[model samples]
Target: MSVQSESVTDTGPEQTVGYTLHGNRYLNITNRCTLRCAFCPRFNDEWTVQEYPLRLRRDPSFEEIVLAVGNPEEYQEIVFCGLGEPTLRLYTLLEVATRLRPHARRIRINTDGLANFVYGRDVTPDMEGLIDALSISLNAQNAEIYNRHCRPKLPGSYEAMLDFVKVAREFVPDITLTAIDGLSGVNIPACKKIAQELGVKFRRRVLDVVG
Candidate 1:
């Protein structure tokens, strides 16, 4: 995983927890994830998006995240995308997003679309105004394909992820379902059709482009 010309600086006790790339700021909030995708960057021995190691010593406090973010208005979008699933720390992500809401022009979350499964409830309503957009990795078209490609920790995560997207479209104004490129045998068109049926925008990314 790689990105261009990103610089890093110490933000005190939090270590190198936040990063910026492609005109967006990102937070490394947690290492917990539901799906272990065959092509996930976090599994790489030297995984990094902004050329900075994102593995955290421990999850930082709200104030620590604030200190790391500084002025959120500086970036095009404040994104909750780290080495792991951002929604694993859903409340923290929402709290931090709320505090930065005034300064941030847009807030987004790049996720695996399993928050509902993680929490055993629909969290979309809570994110309504707080999150400006969502970039959900709908890696496959169906539950069987999803389970085969992205080995989920929870058995029913594929259905849960699809359900999450279906509900989020009602609450979130901007939703984009994404499928990864460069992975053999993935039917991108099928994924796009799924997103269309789900009434969300669609995008594709090279698996190695982490940031």
Candidate 2:
């Protein structure tokens, strides 16, 4: 099911289909999300990375996405990410991942850790073999902080996110808890401790570079 790129142009969002950075390819499927963090780039900026507008004009079709991937073998990894939360397009993500698994050395999902809330069931099992790693945006060290920083759409999203991670460990082979490195009031050390407690990896991403 892996996609193979024919000699497509490497410049412009339209030509690249799935956008590329360094050597990694990213799929930009939708412009929908359940959260509106104050620092989220999609809310404030043009949402382009390296002159590639991540703000997709419309949702890409399955065929379009596969074609966008071009040659998945060219990158070290293929990631599900963009202006929107990847889980909102759950089946699409899995379908694309299934399509890319064979050609991609690694496949990762950068997510808000609310797939369970989005689909109202455990979506982790769907990714068992398709995804190589999961990067869950922890955002804050505690519920209060999460509410302030993440600004989730649903009540108890913070608790639900933690619950998502706990279950993710059972199905998703690898998980990484990440927070913006310098978000005001967010204690990076405490976030690391939370990841340590969960027995997963931790990462501190720079807010300015998230796009």
**What local distance difference test score does each model get?**
0.81, 0.80
lDDT accuracy of residue 141 in candidate 1: 76
Q: Global lDDT for candidate 1?
A: 0.81
In model 2, where do residues sit more than 4 Å from their true spots? 1-17
TM-score of each: 0.91, 0.90
Compared to the true structure, candidate 1 yields what TM-score? 0.91
Error of 2 at 45 (Å): 3.8
Q: What would the per-residue lDDT of candidate 2 be over residues 1-211, giving only the tens digit for each residue?
A: 1233442323344534476665787777777787888887777875755555566667777788888788888988787876788788889889988988888999988899988987889888888888889999999999898889878999889888999999889877889999998788899999999999999999998875643
Worst 10 residues of 2 by lDDT: 1-10
Counted clashes in each candidate structure: 0, 2
List pairs with backbone clashes in candidate 2. 5-70, 5-71
Please give the distance, in angstroms, between residue 191's alpha carbon in candidate 2 and its true position after superposition: 0.2
